[model samples]
Target chain A: MSQHSIAIIGVGKIAVDQHLPVIAKNPAFRLAALVSQRGIEQAGVPTFRTPAELYAAMPDLDAVAICTPPSVRHQVALEALNAGMNVLLEKPPAPTVSELADLVRQAAARRCVLFATWHSQYNAGVEEAKKRLAGRKIASLAITWKEDVRRWHPGQEWIWQPGGFGVFDPGINALSILTEIAPEPFFVTAATLTYPANRDTPIAARLTFASDAGLPGAALTAEFDWRQTGDQTWTIEIVVEDGTRLTLIDGGSKLAINGNLTVAEPMAEYEGIYARFAGLLDRGESAVDAAPFHLVADAMVVGKRETTDAFEW
Target chain B: MSQHSIAIIGVGKIAVDQHLPVIAKNPAFRLAALVSQRGIEQAGVPTFRTPAELYAAMPDLDAVAICTPPSVRHQVALEALNAGMNVLLEKPPAPTVSELADLVRQAAARRCVLFATWHSQYNAGVEEAKKRLAGRKIASLAITWKEDVRRWHPGQEWIWQPGGFGVFDPGINALSILTEIAPEPFFVTAATLTYPANRDTPIAARLTFASDAGLPGAALTAEFDWRQTGDQTWTIEIVVEDGTRLTLIDGGSKLAINGNLTVAEPMAEYEGIYARFAGLLDRGESAVDAAPFHLVADAMVVGKRETTDAFEW
Candidate 1:
């Protein structure tokens, strides 16, 4: 296989912690360059201040993995596609549904690989859970995603701003897994989004969903909170019509069915993402799943907002 | 051609004002039934209290035009689709993008024609405007839609409730026209949505857009308000790269290009919609354009909120 030369745009914490190491381990890709405004660097790799400069410097670069914030992902990915390179986008893809949709069209028009990766959907347990739940009707589903924003984000000011997604930033991981595994398409029927008194986005949300195949009395719901300080929880429990229960715990890194531990392994989500990107690049296919993003945007559109206490770091 | 038997669900103001008269004049269809809880009726047309009753009594109905409020449109349309009938939806389709998407799938699965009608896009002026702007780039575009909520929605309690769409109920009409005529796709870049202190939805909004075709310096913007007491306005002015200006006035009923009035005709948007539905039924096709709805949901996702004075009837 011809190794694809890829560049990492936006060397933030996710890029440094997950993407860089994942790319280094994947033999299908060679880290060709980096673009960062902070002038961050690594040994033996070219660094450019901006994507435009990188494009000019390395005209033959095969692809770019955009690790920028969701607000800027669309523009950076568009530029990369315009410059004749494949692109990869992190979770939530773009700030709004339309932006992600626009990128999908641009990528298809340019005949380049565009992979919108959901890290949570890349785990083995998630894949197995999807298989177990296929061809079945969900009688009930519950998603509880609670985390400490201060511990996980650590002074990330953007989370409290408009379009930052606040609690949804982590909640969407559970949604991605759910959208992938659910037998039939589902939609947000009702939502209550609790906004911090001093913030522009919600600090917590509760959403109710129903499936196209018709759920049992709209028994699907999710609760997302960003205020947990002890014992972070990220879990989804589903009960199918046949009385079989499947549970994905720890953000899909483990799965249990009918009180039996089915699949539990060390999480290698980013590694799986890179491997899938390599396959997509080889086959010239683009995978853009708008389902998870649509649910988030739908929650925003249909949700009733309530103002709560102000959030502090 | 055999006349199609159709029904009108939720006989509200729009049903009485538009759908009833349009169906009466069109030879392609016969008004089969009416579904309304208010016990509304028309001469020689049977009225049923619910869709389930209509489906049971009129099992051979060919199609249904759902004119219910946006919040309940999906469930009504889905039931009609499941009963093996083609469906026509009113403007803005369902309350959320995902609900609309689910209906589209269910209709296709049942081999039923799903026509999501945007009445504003049916005008001759809007069509001409679209033709003129084809293959051209936009330099600047501005949409101003202002109307008095009291005059338009008088005592409609749902408009102030969550998922009611409030000002967006009318604003989406402008967007439907915009999405149909624009040469390329555009996305919400930034927006300020003003919500009334006592309401769950916004009463006004200001949005900026950027096209995938790359508009000239992001000069596309819109202002939607429901506070205009008199001299109501619904207009969109666009300037192309070659300095050709096209203006749609009076809610796409009239068009002027470069200060020359090119098309002006009596508005017959609902008639056009039914005519198109007849053709779609004949061809066994489903026309579901999700662009306009996506833009509205996108605005909600990307918009910053500000609170205004409490709204009262």
Candidate 2:
């Protein structure tokens, strides 16, 4: 079997914690090069300060994993796509959906595979929920994605930046799950976003969605608070009209139905993402799901903004 | 051939100036009903207070023209579509692109037709320009769409609302034209949307687009300013390789090449809109373009907020 040589760009927390470990375990992919402003001291991979040099040095690299911040992802991905390289992008693909759209179009024109992976959907319970929710009427949905950013991200300054998505940093995981489990496609009917007094982005948002049926359409109200002190919550409650309430918790590594525990799996979201990307490459297909990101953009547009307590790192 | 009876909803400025007259003139459509809370004074047509009552009263009405504000357009459209009536929607389609997507899905499921019209692009010179520019290498484009809101919509409060689309109310018209005429799909590379301090919507925006080709993607930057004085500019300049600049002005009602004027038929945007709606209904087809609105929503989400001057009624 021919192995695909891949390069890693923007060696941030994800690159260190997830991509490196996942690539290490996946035999289908060979680590070819790495690019970061700050050099990664990890041996065995050729490190470069920029993407262009990495691509030049590792001419055998077949694909690249882009773990950059959303703001610069579009330009970097465009460069990679233009150079005839397949791409694996993190969630919320680009800073703007238009940029993601541009990248998708560019990838199509260049005939290169582009993967916009929503890692949270690769959780153990998510696929089960997706299978269960298909063709089933969804009555309502409630997601609580409160997390301690300081605990998870430590000193990550980029998450609080203009394009970091702030609270949506965790909220998008819920959205990715919601997009996958919902039977019908939905859009935001109304929303209210709570931005910190001093922050550029919102710290929490309450979004309401309605489906085409307009039959009270699987309403989702999410609260993304980054200041939780104890017992951090990351739960999604989905109530179907058939008296089934599926609660996915612990960042979707666990699932309980009607208060009965059913699932527990080692969370290998990054690994699953790479596996999916490899499957897409094997099939010569592009996996680009803008639906979840589209809802985020729409919610931002329709949602009212309120000032909340200022957040500090 | 049976003439379809159509009802006109939200008989406001656009409805009075465009829709009513167009319905009156189009032989395929007969203006059988008028709907508005403000009470339109058009003679020989019955008026209803709301879209629900309008839909309830006129089950036999084959089609409906929605000229309501963008804020409530999706609800009115949903009701109209659910009642199995063809719809003719004004520019920007729905308040947000996600809502429009839902409407499109709904329209598809019910086998009803929904027409999202771009009145500016319907102007005479647009088709000619598209024909002229086809297959020619487009080096860059600059679209300047500035109009005084005071001159057009004096007391329109909805334009200042969150869903009202701020300066994009007119900018989207330019986007519709650009999206239609461009040889390939383009996405907003970067944008800066300026919101008035007192308003929830953006008052002006500078948007840039790039295409798939490395040709700098027709550097189309659209600036929508509500502060334009006299002669009102709505012009798009396309710069070709030979230094030839093709400008389409007056909302595409006229064209000019290198500062020289090109002829255009008299502008009758609404007339063409009704004609197309009728044609779609006649052919049992639906034409809904959410691309322009998608860009607007994406821009709104990613564009950093900068408060500008406050405005009064």
Candidate 3:
């Protein structure tokens, strides 16, 4: 019932753009502090340079939202969980499944709620689409998530580094939504990952998936690229056996069924994330879904690799 | 207990070399049938071209040992589970964690035992090492598993394909032992994977891991390579906080503690695998240890990728 004091770790672009504003609007969470290497000063909140300093200064903090890149998320999240703080992690959770699994165990051992938040899964229309497609037999599905890395990510060099996930950093958002909406579990049957000649991560990928049990001739495919220059497209289209087609565009912020617009609303992904985090803390549960990340890992595991032209910012 | 009628799926090299012998020696099981695409005939036993035919011919079969490649294991396992037959999968289980997880759920739903056997964990000295390391503070660990791919795998083209796991096929055996022996769970911190210039999978990999709560300065590392030519090496060395050094060599067939030989015995990995599978079936439970495979998947997810010299079979 009381406001949960939450701190934001790694106050980078996402934190400034999405998390801060959402936290400001959500009465359930109060922004308690900011942890960053940069000497960022907030008008009315405390700021610390590291998780250790934040914990030391604000031992009473109820929770912390980690906005760091996936590479360093596990360490920061572990520290918060060990310090008895309910923790919320940004998308893609950790760089590896093992780290996320360890954090889940640690959170349970410490009786803390750890939420591996998939922000895109909280897009305004995601729950609506999930409800609509609950029992429908999916005849076919396609995900087209193409974005220009230059415009979206700019100079974030980490995106090109190993464990940065490159295109998967955005591609995984599509996967998260797909996993949320799919009626049955699916596994990657085949994939081709195209890496820039000079980068450690892929710049584009094509994935084919199949459900364990599906109608004859049913299929699922995803095409993800970081080279789209105009009108960044993020869309998922699903055709049901009953002839109803469902489509979610704009990273799941809009939904259409049978070629008719059904739900198109303003984005509130981060707000939903915080609300869910608060509810998890209240219910004494940990919401750590590794499905989306597992798909990404599976893609990396089974994906055939090819080198493409060198990418430049 | 009556002997369980068990069919061998994917009558490949492993099935012929390991599974058949083990099933023959174990009176608890009877070789019911063989399923393979190859039209090879085994004396005095039934043979079928596919799992469907095998199941169709022998609907009363009690169990099936799936020795298929990891890529196709899930499909076969699901069929067996759905048919109410206890299933045992070879190591590296399914190509992906999601597939294995789905199989686990399917087996649970059907009330059929699903055993994801990590045969190396059943190595002669592995259980001994696990018992000896229990409750001890592990200061550090190093796993060196280098083998000649040509010698071990022969002309196995799948080993170089995506999802074949390349060097990790052997490396996961070491991980299974480590996961069994470690006092606590550990997660990969950093990794370097070297793929051959012409291959989709890594030819060699180096990984670093750390436990969430361990002795100060504790560390673990693994080096796996497929290029070793002569005197193939498979070893794991561990140092306890009290300066006790433990070593397992010859793929866990030999063990030494504090530089003194502690265990040296012939391997019965496959026999042990069958025994565990039978035990699971008897107990109406599933033994799906995803730890080792999770480690491999995590390595792929986080490891830095480097292209090495082209590999020639």
Candidate 4:
């Protein structure tokens, strides 16, 4: 088997910190080129200022990973798919569900692999959690994801703009993991979104969910806030019908059961994503999961809005 | 063929104005019962305060038309499906996409008929427009839907509350027609939502769309407002690649092409809905088109927000 030639688009923080390093070590893919507006380039790789240039120069490129902002990802991926190239999109796929839906259609129509990767769902703990809760009925589940936005996304103005998702940027990672691990599908029942006085998006949100086959007294809820100053927390706790408890901590990188540590390991999320993408490309299949994105859009439509203190850099 | 015993849930404005009359005249259904929170009742029909009571009392009922508020339709229809009854939902189906998705799943799993009726799509003019646009390329499209909320939705506090779509309540009608008539799949590209200072939902919106196969210079847009005081307007104008302009007005009840009126008739939308429902029930299949609902949710997620003047009853 030969390695698939792939180019990385958008050489921003996530691409440099995670995607580039992971592709460098992965034997399934060879880094062919870079398409960056900032003219960012890598050693021994041709760089283009636009995707059209990349497609023209490397028409035989097997695939392209789009790491652009959520707002522009749809157009970028659509152009790549039109050029008969497999495409991979970063988390929160596109700003709108319709854009993502269009990409799914285009990918299938063009017979190209389209992988919408949620980096958090690639952890071993998340996979184990999904396995453990396969046939079990959930009595209750709670997700608490609170972090300092300035600490993680400093000087990122796009996060506050329209289509940026604001606090939902990190909150969707929790939803991605929840969708991956939940035994039954859940829908948002109620929500309250808190927007900064000067921002176009919410800075915090509280959501309640209901499952199809949930038992009596079942409670499903999530709280996401970007105001945490210290001790960042990203955790999900689930209680099954048998009263056994399972907890996923550190954004699904560690797992514990009944207050006992069961699995704790350093996460190689991007590596797992590339591996899955490789498998999908091999089978000529597209994996475009809209559950996590749907949940966020559901919260936005069904949730009540409140004004909070204005956020600042 | 035997007449199916059906019940009307949520005896509200729509139920009284449309569902009862249509069901009374339709030969395929028998009005079995009514579920109303306000204890509203009709001549020669059983009335129950809750769905639980209705289900317990009428276990043999074959189907139910859920005319409840969009916020509670999911729960009501789910229970009806659980009781082995087919369900038909009003326009917009549910408040969130997730809820509607759940209903579709439940209906399929239970082998019950689930018909999500977009009343505007039931018009003869809309059907004709769809037929004319089939296999044709779209050049441009515009939707203008403006109405006085005070006149149409007078004293309806739910229209201003959370989970209430506000202006989108009427705007979705235009979208329903658009989804029915458009030859190619289109997605929301940009939007601006205007919300009253004292309300939870938007009072006006402007949307821009992009199509997969749209011609160059194609401009697709919509303007929805609830502040119109005089004559109401519900219109859609479309231009194909061949430069023929097609127009639909009066909420999809009338159509014109190139200044020539082609189709115009009194709208019997509810009657059309029941006719379709009977066909779906007979075939044991479900028709849940989420395109219109998805566009609204997509706009909510991707659109910028603006604060307008306070709205009052």
Candidate 5:
């Protein structure tokens, strides 16, 4: 308990931009090492090239933060779990839901901690929104998450790679938030995804969900796009039966109801995530949510086919 | 247990064609009553307009099988569980993975059994195939699941509806088999989903998975298409390190390895599933495999999207 010494796999932008600073600020953790193919320094931590090498050398590390692409996180997580270390996995736990299940099973078998951190779920206003909306009958809900890929991702080619999740990479942030805030259980009712013909993933998508049979006349709809021209948007607005509308903007940091300001809080996504992870680790528990990924899968499982014009970056 | 009186919910085509006759043959379960929006009839048992009305009226019903579309199965399952009844839920268990988890959690909370039945996983040859493949390093896998939706599903529009899981409705059957046979978890590396313009879901998709980090050399590639003519294909072929190829036909009824028929078994998909469910119920335990659904979801979350030509009936 002195300090849960942790190493990080896949030292990429997120490792630098969010994870490192969060660890640095939190006294509950100590940055032990960073494992990546190139062994790059995300603000100067010890580096290891592969999971085997990292684990064999660092026997004292208690946990590992997996920041790799979804495709490879499972293998790394499995290794960490097998080596009797806890895991703090990034969103979309593994490249596929199946892999995540295996990881879950493995973690349970090993009695090691596994946390699937949906950063968006930790927004400052999320807990407040969830508490307020619970049991309140929802009339209609809409979420629009669109951003220009070039502006947001810059040179991150992995975003377009096979397991990169393309627009969904960012779109999942919205899904993570929705999964947390929805008062009732909802599933994808219908969806239309648009892919840049040349890319391996969708560039834009329209997703719809309903509360049980899409009956009761309650609905949830989401639009995720990487082609928005101006003003990056990540917002959710819900109209309840009582004739009040709740709007959460900048991905749950600010909120308004009926055009009146309710909560205008600052972003603390990663901070909240780390605090939650620490709690889980402290309690000998595992926190894994596969709902957000399941919705995305439902879209692929049910969505119709379309071929847009090829995109040339 | 006195014919294990069971009620069928959401009596659709699958119930009439598969569930009823199977129940009749089993002799272990008796079709006590059926609950559907539109009551269906055959012989013996009466039908109720809804699950609430049926369960309310029948105190003799010992178990319930909720066979609705994936989108709404969770509610019926939850309802059945709440009524102090063991539940046999069709594939999906619910519209979303999270819902499935909730059902799993709910059944535990109530101490009543909930069965997430994957009809295909019980295929006659699956166990034999799984035994043969276990512990052996899998080199690669190929799943080809193609059928004429118009012929099989006909005017059943709900199959293409979101949460209905489009081609994955069938493809997931393939995954159920793959997940059972494989030794380790695999993640989707790349995918191109082809959807028809008129529909909200994809008609065809190519999904690839790897045991490691999108390793270049060898892996499993699953191909699912709704547009098939003449002889339909549902098969899984595994390539091993010894240069031997193994194939299972009729969803694991027949198996052959390296040009020699290593095993050719009978089809018993439904019975196998029921047998396992019975065993689980006897042990007061749950055997749920979310691997198939997770794989599908992970692919959707990460796979790039594309749209193809419009599908016509």
Candidate 6:
């Protein structure tokens, strides 16, 4: 029941905007240190330039939250786990499934809780929707997640680089919600991924999925694009066999059933993530879900490539 | 045991060269029918242009072996499984991890034997090598699998298309052996994939792997390419902690220990594949190994993409 001493690694935008405030509010965790290369300093907290330095200085740290980009998260996480610290990973968890799988094993070997956080899965309406659709036979499902890269990611060069995941960086949030709320698991049957003429990653993608049992009239589709200039949309709609419709909008912060608003609340994805991580740490269990990552990798594996007009910031 | 009436779907080069002869020699399976678009007919066997036609005409078919290109294999395998027939999928399975996972689920629900055959895992010396390395400490491992796609594939255009897996089609065979023989599971850490200027898939790949527990001084690497014109080489070399070396050559048909030949035998990959499938069917169990496919998918997920000169058949 004692407060878990946690350090924040990679004090980037996400760490400041989401993690810091949440950790400040959570009673179960105390911010012990900050690790960042940018030399950002937090008042009343020890700051180190790297995870190695942080571990050396604060060997008693109970856990560390990694908010770095997917490309570099693995090394930092591995180091923390190796040092016997419980670890929490941000979305799109390592660049590849293999790296993430390795981390899971490492955490188990070290007896440290490794939580791969899918922030979107913690959206307020997600659990509510999952509860409502628990036994329903889904007839069809559709996900539309379109956002303007310029408006959201402004000037972030890593988004276009390999392992950056391009649109999938945001698109995976949708998949995380879908995988969490779906009545049953589904797999991608076909996909078409559109890449900017000059980039290594796709700017837009369309994927179709199917249930393993081939449910009658069951169809699922996910369309992700970074070209939306106005009225950015993030929505998932599922129709059950009895014609009951369920929709989650605003990135799963709101829920509506058959055109009637049921649950609309403020977003607290990161807070829920930390609370879950704390619970897992208390229970000595690792919560590393590979479904969302598997779907993203499957999209890349089967997606047909098409070149689009060059994208400019 | 009664002979299982099995149908061959998509009688391509692999089916003719490997499946036909293996089935002919296996006493547990009877080649009941053939399904193909090429109009190649086998004496005294009924032929259908499609799997649906074959299923309609012979509803009593016990099993089916799908040898179609991966892009189209999922649909055929799903159809066969839906009709309550046990299924045997060719190597690399059904294009993506999701598809293969779906098939495994479907077969389990239907109580049908679903065998995802990794033909190379059945190579003559693979088991012997696995036995030798079972309790050894691996210091390092290397896999070199280079072959001429021009000579092996000739004009197989499908190999260059999306989902074809390019060099990975053959590269996965190496992985099949690696996954089968390694003392512990390994995951990819980094990869570089080379794509032809005009192709959708990679023509070569280099990947590095590491164990979860950080095996003492252990390093693993795989190099796969389709440009080896002469002197086609498919070999795996492993170094143990005590300086003992193990090598598998000729696509795992031969094994050497400390530079001395330990096992040398003719390649009968497909024959072994059929024998394994028969055993699974007799035991009413589904044998589906997704490790090799998972590694390939991980490579694509984290791999840096580089464009090479345009490839011409």
Indicate the fraction of true inter-chain contacts that candidate 2 also forms: 0.61
Could you give candidate 5's per-residue lDDT for residues B44-109 as a string of tens digits?
A: 888898888887899767788788876677777888888888888888666666677778888899
Model 5 over residues A117-180: C-alpha lDDT tens digits? 9988887677777887887878888899988887888877777776677787888888888888
Candidate 6 residue-pair clash tally: 0
Error (Å) of candidate 3 at residue A71 is 2.0
Better of 4 and 5 by DockQ: 4
Query: What is each candidate's fraction of native interface contacts (fnat)?
Result: 0.78, 0.61, 0.82, 0.81, 0.78, 0.70
Docking band of candidate 2:
medium
Measured on C-alpha atoms, candidate 4 has an lDDT of 0.90
lDDT of 2 by residue, B151-229 (tens): 8879989888766777888888898888777766667656787877788887788877666531653566778888786
Clashing pairs in 2: none
Query: Which segments of candidate 3 are over 4 A away from where they belong?
Result: A56-60, B1-3, B37-45, B53-60, B212-219
True A-B contacts kept by model 3: 0.82
Which of 3 and 5 is ahead in TM-score?
3
Model 4 spans > 4 angstroms off = A1-3, A56-60, A212-215, B1-5, B36-62, B137-139
lDDT by residue (tens digit), candidate 3, A1-313: 6789999998888899999999999998889999989978789998899899998898999999899877778888888987889988888788888788888888999999989988899887788888877877788889999999999889989888877888999999999998888788979988999999989889999999988335677878999999999899999988888878889989999999988989999988887888888888888889988899999999999999999999888
* Cα lDDT of model 6 by residue, B1-313, tens digit: 6688899998988999999988999999999999989888999898899888998999999999999878777778989988889999987788777677778877888899999889889876899988878877788899999999999989989888877888999999999998899887777877899999999889999999876423566778999999998799999998877788899999999999999999999998888898888888788889888889999998887677888999998
The DockQ scores of all candidates, in the order shown, are 0.75, 0.50, 0.78, 0.73, 0.54, 0.52
Please state the interface RMSD for every predicted structure, separated by commas: 1.0, 2.1, 1.0, 1.1, 3.2, 1.9
**Greater-DockQ candidate between 3 and 4:** 3
- Tell me the alpha-carbon RMSD of every candidate: 2.4, 4.1, 2.3, 2.6, 3.6, 4.5
lDDT of 1 by residue, A1-313 (tens): 6799999999998999999999999999999999999989999998999999999999999999999888888889989999999999988799888788888888999999999999999988899988988888888899999999999999899888878888999999989998999888888988999998899889899999978543558489999999988999998988888888888999999898987888999999999999999999989999988889999999999899999998888
Model 6: colliding residue pairs: none
